[model samples]
Target: MTADATKRLCDVVLDETIGRATPDVEHERAVAIFDLLEENSFAPVGHDKGPYKLALSLVDSKLVFSITGEKGEPVATHILSLTPFRRIVKDYFMICESYYEAIRSSSPSQIEAIDMGRRGVHNEGSQTLKDRLEGKIDIDFDTARRLFTLVCVLHWRG
Candidate 1:
Protein backbone atom coordinates (compact mmCIF):
# COMPACT_ATOMS: atom_id res chain seq x y z
CA MET A 1 0.00 0.00 0.00
CA THR A 2 1.11 3.56 -0.59
CA ALA A 3 2.10 5.75 2.36
CA ASP A 4 -0.87 8.03 1.76
CA ALA A 5 -3.44 5.27 2.30
CA THR A 6 -1.84 3.90 5.44
CA LYS A 7 -3.71 4.20 8.75
CA ARG A 8 -1.84 3.37 11.90
CA LEU A 9 -3.31 1.13 14.58
CA CYS A 10 -3.09 2.43 18.10
CA ASP A 11 -3.11 -1.06 19.55
CA VAL A 12 -4.06 -4.65 18.81
CA VAL A 13 -5.29 -7.23 21.30
CA LEU A 14 -6.21 -10.91 21.32
CA ASP A 15 -8.76 -12.45 23.63
CA GLU A 16 -7.15 -14.39 26.45
CA THR A 17 -10.21 -16.63 26.54
CA ILE A 18 -8.93 -18.26 23.37
CA GLY A 19 -6.45 -20.08 25.63
CA ARG A 20 -2.68 -20.10 25.47
CA ALA A 21 -1.07 -20.23 22.05
CA THR A 22 2.00 -22.14 20.91
CA PRO A 23 5.34 -20.35 20.50
CA ASP A 24 4.95 -20.16 16.75
CA VAL A 25 1.45 -18.77 17.08
CA GLU A 26 2.63 -16.24 19.63
CA HIS A 27 5.41 -15.15 17.28
CA GLU A 28 2.99 -14.69 14.40
CA ARG A 29 0.66 -12.64 16.57
CA ALA A 30 3.52 -10.52 17.84
CA VAL A 31 4.85 -9.72 14.38
CA ALA A 32 1.39 -8.94 13.06
CA ILE A 33 0.66 -6.64 15.96
CA PHE A 34 3.98 -4.86 15.57
CA ASP A 35 3.80 -4.53 11.81
CA LEU A 36 0.12 -3.63 11.76
CA LEU A 37 0.66 -0.88 14.30
CA GLU A 38 3.70 0.36 12.43
CA GLU A 39 1.72 0.75 9.17
CA ASN A 40 -1.79 -0.27 8.20
CA SER A 41 -4.98 0.88 6.50
CA PHE A 42 -8.11 0.23 8.57
CA ALA A 43 -11.14 2.47 8.14
CA PRO A 44 -14.48 1.15 9.36
CA VAL A 45 -17.36 1.46 6.95
CA GLY A 46 -18.96 4.89 6.92
CA HIS A 47 -16.24 6.34 9.11
CA ASP A 48 -13.40 7.99 7.25
CA LYS A 49 -11.46 8.74 10.42
CA GLY A 50 -8.90 6.44 12.01
CA PRO A 51 -5.90 5.61 14.21
CA TYR A 52 -7.96 2.66 15.45
CA LYS A 53 -7.54 -0.09 18.01
CA LEU A 54 -8.49 -3.62 17.07
CA ALA A 55 -9.30 -6.66 19.18
CA LEU A 56 -9.45 -10.10 17.61
CA SER A 57 -11.13 -13.19 19.05
CA LEU A 58 -13.25 -16.21 18.32
CA VAL A 59 -16.85 -16.17 19.45
CA ASP A 60 -18.57 -19.52 19.36
CA SER A 61 -17.22 -20.59 15.95
CA LYS A 62 -16.92 -17.20 14.30
CA LEU A 63 -14.05 -14.78 13.97
CA VAL A 64 -14.79 -11.38 15.51
CA PHE A 65 -13.03 -8.13 14.69
CA SER A 66 -13.75 -5.45 17.26
CA ILE A 67 -12.68 -1.98 16.16
CA THR A 68 -12.52 1.08 18.32
CA GLY A 69 -11.33 4.64 18.14
CA GLU A 70 -7.94 5.65 19.44
CA LYS A 71 -9.60 6.79 22.65
CA GLY A 72 -11.31 3.36 23.04
CA GLU A 73 -14.87 4.16 21.94
CA PRO A 74 -16.60 1.55 19.79
CA VAL A 75 -16.32 2.00 16.05
CA ALA A 76 -17.59 -1.19 14.47
CA THR A 77 -17.53 -4.98 14.77
CA HIS A 78 -17.24 -7.54 11.97
CA ILE A 79 -17.78 -11.21 12.49
CA LEU A 80 -16.89 -13.68 9.74
CA SER A 81 -17.40 -17.39 9.30
CA LEU A 82 -14.36 -19.62 9.10
CA THR A 83 -15.83 -21.73 6.32
CA PRO A 84 -14.60 -19.63 3.39
CA PHE A 85 -11.07 -19.51 4.76
CA ARG A 86 -10.74 -23.14 5.74
CA ARG A 87 -8.89 -24.35 2.68
CA ILE A 88 -6.41 -21.53 2.38
CA VAL A 89 -5.72 -21.42 6.09
CA LYS A 90 -5.19 -25.15 6.23
CA ASP A 91 -2.84 -24.97 3.26
CA TYR A 92 -0.98 -22.05 4.83
CA PHE A 93 -0.39 -23.98 8.05
CA MET A 94 0.82 -27.03 6.19
CA ILE A 95 3.23 -24.99 4.06
CA CYS A 96 4.45 -23.11 7.14
CA GLU A 97 5.31 -26.40 8.80
CA SER A 98 7.15 -27.51 5.69
CA TYR A 99 9.03 -24.24 5.50
CA TYR A 100 10.17 -24.54 9.10
CA GLU A 101 11.28 -28.13 8.56
CA ALA A 102 13.06 -27.25 5.35
CA ILE A 103 14.90 -24.37 7.00
CA ARG A 104 16.36 -26.77 9.53
CA SER A 105 18.33 -28.88 7.05
CA SER A 106 17.48 -28.12 3.44
CA SER A 107 19.80 -26.53 0.85
CA PRO A 108 19.52 -22.77 0.26
CA SER A 109 17.78 -23.28 -3.09
CA GLN A 110 15.30 -25.70 -1.48
CA ILE A 111 14.62 -23.30 1.36
CA GLU A 112 13.99 -20.44 -1.09
CA ALA A 113 11.57 -22.60 -3.05
CA ILE A 114 9.62 -23.42 0.10
CA ASP A 115 9.63 -19.78 1.16
CA MET A 116 8.19 -18.77 -2.20
CA GLY A 117 5.39 -21.28 -1.83
CA ARG A 118 4.73 -20.09 1.69
CA ARG A 119 4.47 -16.51 0.45
CA GLY A 120 2.10 -17.58 -2.29
CA VAL A 121 -0.20 -19.27 0.22
CA HIS A 122 0.02 -16.23 2.47
CA ASN A 123 -0.99 -13.96 -0.42
CA GLU A 124 -3.98 -16.16 -1.18
CA GLY A 125 -5.12 -15.98 2.43
CA SER A 126 -4.74 -12.21 2.36
CA GLN A 127 -6.76 -11.86 -0.82
CA THR A 128 -9.48 -14.09 0.58
CA LEU A 129 -9.67 -11.95 3.70
CA LYS A 130 -9.89 -8.80 1.60
CA ASP A 131 -12.72 -10.28 -0.43
CA ARG A 132 -14.57 -11.45 2.68
CA LEU A 133 -14.36 -8.03 4.27
CA GLU A 134 -15.05 -6.18 1.05
CA GLY A 135 -17.70 -3.73 2.19
CA LYS A 136 -17.50 -4.17 5.93
CA ILE A 137 -13.89 -3.09 6.36
CA ASP A 138 -11.48 -1.48 3.95
CA ILE A 139 -7.89 -2.62 4.13
CA ASP A 140 -4.98 -2.62 1.73
CA PHE A 141 -3.17 -5.74 0.55
CA ASP A 142 -0.36 -5.44 3.10
CA THR A 143 -2.86 -4.91 5.91
CA ALA A 144 -4.87 -7.92 4.79
CA ARG A 145 -1.72 -10.04 4.65
CA ARG A 146 -0.78 -9.27 8.23
CA LEU A 147 -4.35 -9.69 9.45
CA PHE A 148 -4.55 -13.06 7.74
CA THR A 149 -1.54 -14.28 9.68
CA LEU A 150 -3.13 -13.23 12.96
CA VAL A 151 -6.34 -15.00 11.95
CA CYS A 152 -4.36 -18.14 11.22
CA VAL A 153 -2.80 -17.91 14.64
CA LEU A 154 -6.28 -17.83 16.16
CA HIS A 155 -7.46 -20.62 13.90
CA TRP A 156 -4.60 -22.81 15.15
CA ARG A 157 -6.87 -23.61 18.08
CA GLY A 158 -9.57 -24.84 15.74
Candidate 2:
Protein backbone atom coordinates (compact mmCIF):
# COMPACT_ATOMS: atom_id res chain seq x y z
CA MET A 1 0.00 0.00 0.00
CA THR A 2 1.08 3.54 -0.63
CA ALA A 3 1.79 5.83 2.30
CA ASP A 4 -1.51 7.57 1.55
CA ALA A 5 -3.31 4.26 1.72
CA THR A 6 -1.63 3.46 5.00
CA LYS A 7 -2.58 6.80 6.45
CA ARG A 8 -6.12 6.42 5.23
CA LEU A 9 -6.27 2.95 6.78
CA CYS A 10 -5.05 4.31 10.08
CA ASP A 11 -7.58 7.11 9.95
CA VAL A 12 -10.50 4.78 9.39
CA VAL A 13 -9.42 2.56 12.25
CA LEU A 14 -8.99 5.51 14.54
CA ASP A 15 -12.29 7.05 13.51
CA GLU A 16 -15.09 7.69 15.98
CA THR A 17 -17.55 5.01 15.01
CA ILE A 18 -15.33 1.98 15.17
CA GLY A 19 -12.23 3.05 17.00
CA ARG A 20 -13.31 6.09 18.96
CA ALA A 21 -16.57 4.66 20.21
CA THR A 22 -15.08 3.97 23.59
CA PRO A 23 -11.45 4.86 24.08
CA ASP A 24 -11.11 3.19 27.44
CA VAL A 25 -12.75 0.01 26.24
CA GLU A 26 -10.56 -0.03 23.15
CA HIS A 27 -7.45 0.66 25.21
CA GLU A 28 -8.18 -2.20 27.55
CA ARG A 29 -8.82 -4.53 24.65
CA ALA A 30 -5.67 -3.42 22.85
CA VAL A 31 -3.56 -4.00 25.95
CA ALA A 32 -4.96 -7.50 26.35
CA ILE A 33 -4.19 -8.40 22.73
CA PHE A 34 -0.74 -6.90 22.93
CA ASP A 35 0.03 -9.01 25.99
CA LEU A 36 -1.03 -12.12 24.16
CA LEU A 37 0.95 -11.21 21.08
CA GLU A 38 4.15 -10.60 23.04
CA GLU A 39 3.89 -13.63 25.27
CA ASN A 40 4.90 -17.30 24.97
CA SER A 41 1.65 -18.59 26.37
CA PHE A 42 -0.23 -19.82 23.32
CA ALA A 43 0.60 -23.16 21.72
CA PRO A 44 2.60 -22.76 18.51
CA VAL A 45 0.62 -25.42 16.74
CA GLY A 46 -1.88 -26.31 19.44
CA HIS A 47 0.71 -28.45 21.17
CA ASP A 48 0.96 -28.85 24.92
CA LYS A 49 4.71 -28.55 24.70
CA GLY A 50 4.60 -25.08 23.25
CA PRO A 51 4.97 -21.72 24.87
CA TYR A 52 5.89 -20.19 21.56
CA LYS A 53 6.66 -16.52 21.27
CA LEU A 54 4.53 -14.52 18.82
CA ALA A 55 5.88 -11.84 16.55
CA LEU A 56 4.47 -9.44 13.94
CA SER A 57 6.22 -8.16 10.87
CA LEU A 58 4.79 -5.83 8.29
CA VAL A 59 4.90 -6.86 4.64
CA ASP A 60 4.53 -3.61 2.76
CA SER A 61 4.52 -5.44 -0.54
CA LYS A 62 1.50 -7.44 0.50
CA LEU A 63 -0.03 -4.56 2.42
CA VAL A 64 -0.61 -6.91 5.30
CA PHE A 65 1.15 -8.01 8.44
CA SER A 66 2.73 -11.42 8.94
CA ILE A 67 2.16 -13.24 12.16
CA THR A 68 5.26 -15.33 12.69
CA GLY A 69 6.80 -17.49 15.39
CA GLU A 70 10.38 -18.02 16.50
CA LYS A 71 12.95 -18.69 13.79
CA GLY A 72 13.61 -22.19 12.37
CA GLU A 73 10.30 -23.34 13.74
CA PRO A 74 8.44 -26.05 11.90
CA VAL A 75 5.87 -24.57 9.53
CA ALA A 76 3.14 -26.95 10.64
CA THR A 77 3.99 -26.36 14.24
CA HIS A 78 4.03 -22.64 13.60
CA ILE A 79 0.75 -22.70 11.70
CA LEU A 80 -0.98 -24.87 14.27
CA SER A 81 0.51 -22.84 17.07
CA LEU A 82 -0.44 -19.39 15.88
CA THR A 83 -3.14 -19.84 13.31
CA PRO A 84 -6.06 -18.61 15.39
CA PHE A 85 -4.14 -15.75 16.90
CA ARG A 86 -2.82 -14.78 13.53
CA ARG A 87 -6.28 -14.81 12.05
CA ILE A 88 -7.57 -12.46 14.66
CA VAL A 89 -4.78 -9.98 14.05
CA LYS A 90 -5.01 -10.26 10.31
CA ASP A 91 -8.76 -9.90 10.25
CA TYR A 92 -8.71 -6.95 12.53
CA PHE A 93 -6.30 -5.05 10.31
CA MET A 94 -8.08 -6.05 7.16
CA ILE A 95 -11.42 -5.03 8.55
CA CYS A 96 -10.05 -1.63 9.43
CA GLU A 97 -8.36 -1.21 6.09
CA SER A 98 -11.36 -2.38 4.14
CA TYR A 99 -13.49 0.16 5.90
CA TYR A 100 -10.99 2.92 5.21
CA GLU A 101 -10.57 1.97 1.62
CA ALA A 102 -14.27 1.85 1.00
CA ILE A 103 -14.75 5.25 2.53
CA ARG A 104 -11.80 6.77 0.71
CA SER A 105 -12.93 5.41 -2.60
CA SER A 106 -16.50 6.48 -2.01
CA SER A 107 -18.23 9.64 -0.94
CA PRO A 108 -18.70 8.54 2.65
CA SER A 109 -16.81 9.97 5.57
CA GLN A 110 -14.07 7.86 7.06
CA ILE A 111 -16.20 7.21 10.13
CA GLU A 112 -19.04 5.92 7.99
CA ALA A 113 -16.68 3.55 6.29
CA ILE A 114 -15.46 2.34 9.64
CA ASP A 115 -19.00 1.75 10.78
CA MET A 116 -19.73 -0.21 7.67
CA GLY A 117 -16.60 -2.24 8.10
CA ARG A 118 -17.33 -2.91 11.75
CA ARG A 119 -20.83 -3.99 10.83
CA GLY A 120 -19.49 -6.24 8.15
CA VAL A 121 -17.19 -7.92 10.61
CA HIS A 122 -20.05 -8.41 13.01
CA ASN A 123 -22.47 -9.61 10.39
CA GLU A 124 -19.96 -11.65 8.42
CA GLY A 125 -19.02 -14.12 11.14
CA SER A 126 -16.34 -12.35 13.10
CA GLN A 127 -17.77 -14.38 15.95
CA THR A 128 -16.70 -17.54 14.20
CA LEU A 129 -13.20 -16.14 14.07
CA LYS A 130 -13.51 -15.18 17.69
CA ASP A 131 -14.74 -18.64 18.59
CA ARG A 132 -11.68 -20.11 16.94
CA LEU A 133 -9.47 -17.67 18.82
CA GLU A 134 -11.23 -17.77 22.16
CA GLY A 135 -9.62 -19.87 24.90
CA LYS A 136 -6.72 -20.23 22.48
CA ILE A 137 -5.56 -16.68 23.11
CA ASP A 138 -6.43 -14.03 25.65
CA ILE A 139 -7.14 -10.97 23.59
CA ASP A 140 -9.86 -8.56 22.45
CA PHE A 141 -10.52 -6.13 19.60
CA ASP A 142 -8.92 -3.04 21.09
CA THR A 143 -5.64 -4.73 21.80
CA ALA A 144 -5.48 -5.88 18.22
CA ARG A 145 -5.74 -2.26 17.04
CA ARG A 146 -3.16 -1.11 19.53
CA LEU A 147 -0.80 -3.86 18.48
CA PHE A 148 -1.23 -2.79 14.88
CA THR A 149 -0.49 0.79 15.78
CA LEU A 150 2.60 -0.19 17.68
CA VAL A 151 3.84 -2.30 14.82
CA CYS A 152 3.31 0.57 12.40
CA VAL A 153 5.07 3.02 14.65
CA LEU A 154 8.04 0.78 15.33
CA HIS A 155 8.54 -0.15 11.70
CA TRP A 156 11.37 1.51 9.77
CA ARG A 157 10.13 4.63 8.02
CA GLY A 158 12.80 4.73 5.35
Candidate 3:
Protein backbone atom coordinates (compact mmCIF):
# COMPACT_ATOMS: atom_id res chain seq x y z
CA MET A 1 0.00 0.00 0.00
CA THR A 2 1.12 3.53 -0.68
CA ALA A 3 1.76 5.97 2.15
CA ASP A 4 -1.21 8.12 1.16
CA ALA A 5 -4.42 6.37 1.99
CA THR A 6 -6.26 9.09 0.10
CA LYS A 7 -4.89 7.90 -3.21
CA ARG A 8 -5.94 4.28 -2.92
CA LEU A 9 -9.09 2.61 -4.21
CA CYS A 10 -11.28 1.03 -1.55
CA ASP A 11 -13.67 -0.77 -3.82
CA VAL A 12 -14.24 -1.56 -7.49
CA VAL A 13 -17.41 -2.41 -9.39
CA LEU A 14 -17.79 -3.51 -12.97
CA ASP A 15 -21.05 -2.53 -14.61
CA GLU A 16 -23.76 -5.18 -14.72
CA THR A 17 -23.69 -4.77 -18.46
CA ILE A 18 -20.47 -6.78 -18.29
CA GLY A 19 -22.80 -9.71 -17.53
CA ARG A 20 -21.31 -13.17 -17.08
CA ALA A 21 -17.76 -14.12 -17.99
CA THR A 22 -16.10 -17.49 -18.39
CA PRO A 23 -14.72 -19.07 -15.23
CA ASP A 24 -11.16 -18.19 -16.24
CA VAL A 25 -12.10 -14.60 -16.92
CA GLU A 26 -14.05 -14.40 -13.68
CA HIS A 27 -11.01 -15.65 -11.83
CA GLU A 28 -8.81 -13.06 -13.50
CA ARG A 29 -11.28 -10.30 -12.66
CA ALA A 30 -11.50 -11.37 -9.06
CA VAL A 31 -7.75 -11.50 -8.68
CA ALA A 32 -7.20 -8.17 -10.39
CA ILE A 33 -9.73 -6.42 -8.16
CA PHE A 34 -8.38 -8.07 -5.05
CA ASP A 35 -4.80 -7.14 -5.90
CA LEU A 36 -5.82 -3.59 -6.84
CA LEU A 37 -7.55 -3.05 -3.53
CA GLU A 38 -4.59 -4.43 -1.67
CA GLU A 39 -2.13 -1.98 -3.21
CA ASN A 40 -2.75 0.81 -5.73
CA SER A 41 -2.40 4.54 -6.23
CA PHE A 42 -5.46 6.09 -7.86
CA ALA A 43 -6.25 9.77 -7.47
CA PRO A 44 -8.56 11.77 -9.65
CA VAL A 45 -6.95 14.96 -10.80
CA GLY A 46 -8.10 18.22 -9.14
CA HIS A 47 -10.23 16.31 -6.65
CA ASP A 48 -9.13 16.01 -3.03
CA LYS A 49 -11.18 12.88 -2.57
CA GLY A 50 -9.64 9.97 -0.70
CA PRO A 51 -10.26 6.26 -0.59
CA TYR A 52 -12.13 6.07 -3.88
CA LYS A 53 -14.44 3.53 -5.42
CA LEU A 54 -14.39 2.77 -9.14
CA ALA A 55 -17.04 1.70 -11.59
CA LEU A 56 -15.72 0.45 -14.94
CA SER A 57 -17.91 -0.10 -17.96
CA LEU A 58 -17.94 -0.28 -21.71
CA VAL A 59 -20.47 1.98 -23.41
CA ASP A 60 -20.67 2.70 -27.13
CA SER A 61 -17.17 1.42 -27.73
CA LYS A 62 -15.75 3.56 -24.97
CA LEU A 63 -14.15 2.64 -21.69
CA VAL A 64 -15.74 4.59 -18.84
CA PHE A 65 -14.13 5.03 -15.50
CA SER A 66 -16.52 6.33 -12.85
CA ILE A 67 -14.81 7.40 -9.68
CA THR A 68 -16.56 8.04 -6.39
CA GLY A 69 -15.79 8.81 -2.81
CA GLU A 70 -15.91 6.18 -0.11
CA LYS A 71 -19.53 7.05 0.62
CA GLY A 72 -20.39 6.99 -3.10
CA GLU A 73 -20.18 10.68 -3.85
CA PRO A 74 -19.29 11.42 -7.47
CA VAL A 75 -15.66 12.30 -7.99
CA ALA A 76 -14.81 12.02 -11.67
CA THR A 77 -15.68 10.13 -14.81
CA HIS A 78 -13.19 9.51 -17.62
CA ILE A 79 -14.42 8.03 -20.87
CA LEU A 80 -11.82 6.75 -23.33
CA SER A 81 -12.27 5.49 -26.84
CA LEU A 82 -11.50 1.83 -27.26
CA THR A 83 -10.05 2.25 -30.73
CA PRO A 84 -6.45 2.61 -29.61
CA PHE A 85 -6.68 -0.57 -27.62
CA ARG A 86 -8.38 -2.82 -30.12
CA ARG A 87 -5.33 -4.19 -31.88
CA ILE A 88 -3.24 -4.49 -28.77
CA VAL A 89 -6.03 -6.24 -26.92
CA LYS A 90 -6.47 -8.70 -29.75
CA ASP A 91 -2.74 -9.40 -29.80
CA TYR A 92 -2.75 -9.90 -26.04
CA PHE A 93 -5.46 -12.50 -26.21
CA MET A 94 -3.64 -14.34 -28.93
CA ILE A 95 -0.51 -14.47 -26.85
CA CYS A 96 -2.50 -15.63 -23.84
CA GLU A 97 -4.00 -18.50 -25.80
CA SER A 98 -0.57 -19.52 -27.01
CA TYR A 99 0.79 -19.37 -23.48
CA TYR A 100 -2.04 -21.51 -22.15
CA GLU A 101 -1.59 -24.10 -24.86
CA ALA A 102 2.15 -24.09 -24.27
CA ILE A 103 1.56 -24.72 -20.58
CA ARG A 104 -0.42 -27.86 -21.36
CA SER A 105 1.95 -29.49 -23.83
CA SER A 106 5.11 -27.53 -24.60
CA SER A 107 8.49 -28.01 -22.96
CA PRO A 108 9.49 -25.75 -20.06
CA SER A 109 11.69 -23.53 -22.22
CA GLN A 110 9.04 -23.19 -24.89
CA ILE A 111 6.44 -22.33 -22.28
CA GLU A 112 8.74 -19.71 -20.79
CA ALA A 113 9.24 -18.11 -24.18
CA ILE A 114 5.51 -17.85 -24.75
CA ASP A 115 4.99 -16.57 -21.23
CA MET A 116 7.55 -13.84 -21.87
CA GLY A 117 5.69 -12.76 -24.97
CA ARG A 118 2.43 -12.74 -23.03
CA ARG A 119 4.00 -10.51 -20.37
CA GLY A 120 5.35 -8.16 -23.02
CA VAL A 121 1.91 -7.74 -24.49
CA HIS A 122 0.44 -7.17 -21.06
CA ASN A 123 3.06 -4.49 -20.42
CA GLU A 124 2.24 -2.81 -23.69
CA GLY A 125 -1.40 -2.65 -22.71
CA SER A 126 -0.49 -1.21 -19.36
CA GLN A 127 1.58 1.52 -20.95
CA THR A 128 -1.22 2.33 -23.35
CA LEU A 129 -3.62 2.64 -20.43
CA LYS A 130 -1.26 4.95 -18.59
CA ASP A 131 -0.93 7.11 -21.68
CA ARG A 132 -4.70 7.32 -22.07
CA LEU A 133 -5.29 8.20 -18.44
CA GLU A 134 -2.39 10.66 -18.42
CA GLY A 135 -4.05 13.76 -17.00
CA LYS A 136 -7.42 12.48 -15.87
CA ILE A 137 -6.12 10.14 -13.21
CA ASP A 138 -2.76 9.61 -11.54
CA ILE A 139 -1.79 5.97 -11.16
CA ASP A 140 1.41 4.01 -10.82
CA PHE A 141 2.58 1.44 -13.38
CA ASP A 142 1.48 -1.45 -11.20
CA THR A 143 -1.96 0.12 -10.87
CA ALA A 144 -2.13 0.62 -14.61
CA ARG A 145 -1.20 -3.01 -15.12
CA ARG A 146 -4.00 -4.19 -12.86
CA LEU A 147 -6.47 -1.81 -14.50
CA PHE A 148 -5.37 -3.11 -17.88
CA THR A 149 -6.24 -6.59 -16.70
CA LEU A 150 -9.72 -5.30 -15.90
CA VAL A 151 -9.92 -3.71 -19.34
CA CYS A 152 -9.13 -7.09 -20.88
CA VAL A 153 -11.86 -8.54 -18.70
CA LEU A 154 -14.31 -6.07 -20.26
CA HIS A 155 -13.42 -7.43 -23.67
CA TRP A 156 -13.89 -11.03 -22.67
CA ARG A 157 -17.02 -12.30 -24.47
CA GLY A 158 -17.22 -15.75 -23.01
Which candidate leads in lDDT? Answer: 3
Local accuracy of candidate 3 as per-residue lDDT tens digits, 38-128 = 8999999887668999998878888789999999999999998989999999999999899989989999999999988899999999999
**Clash total of candidate 3:** 0
| True-structure lDDT of candidate 3 | 0.90
Is candidate 1 or 2 superior in TM-score? Answer: 1
| Candidate 2, poorest ten consecutive residues by summed lDDT | 6-15
Best by TM-score: 3
- lDDT winner between candidates 1 and 2: 1
Query: Candidate 1: worst 10 consecutive residues by lDDT?
Result: 1-10
Summarize candidate 2's per-residue lDDT along 1-158 as a digit string, tens digits.
22222111111112121223255555654554454344322332243322233433223222232222343243221112233344444565567667767766756676686777676554334344334455544334543444434433232121
- The sequence of per-residue lDDT tens digits that candidate 1 reaches over residues 4-67 is 5425577899887556777887776688688777768888778866778888877777888899
Ranking of all predicted structures according to TM-score, beginning with the best and ending with the worst: 3, 1, 2
Quote the lDDT for 6 in model 3. Answer: 94
Please provide TM-scores, in order, for all candidate models, with all chains considered together.
0.87, 0.27, 0.93
Question: What residue runs in model 1 are displaced by over 4 Å at the alpha carbon?
Answer: 1-6
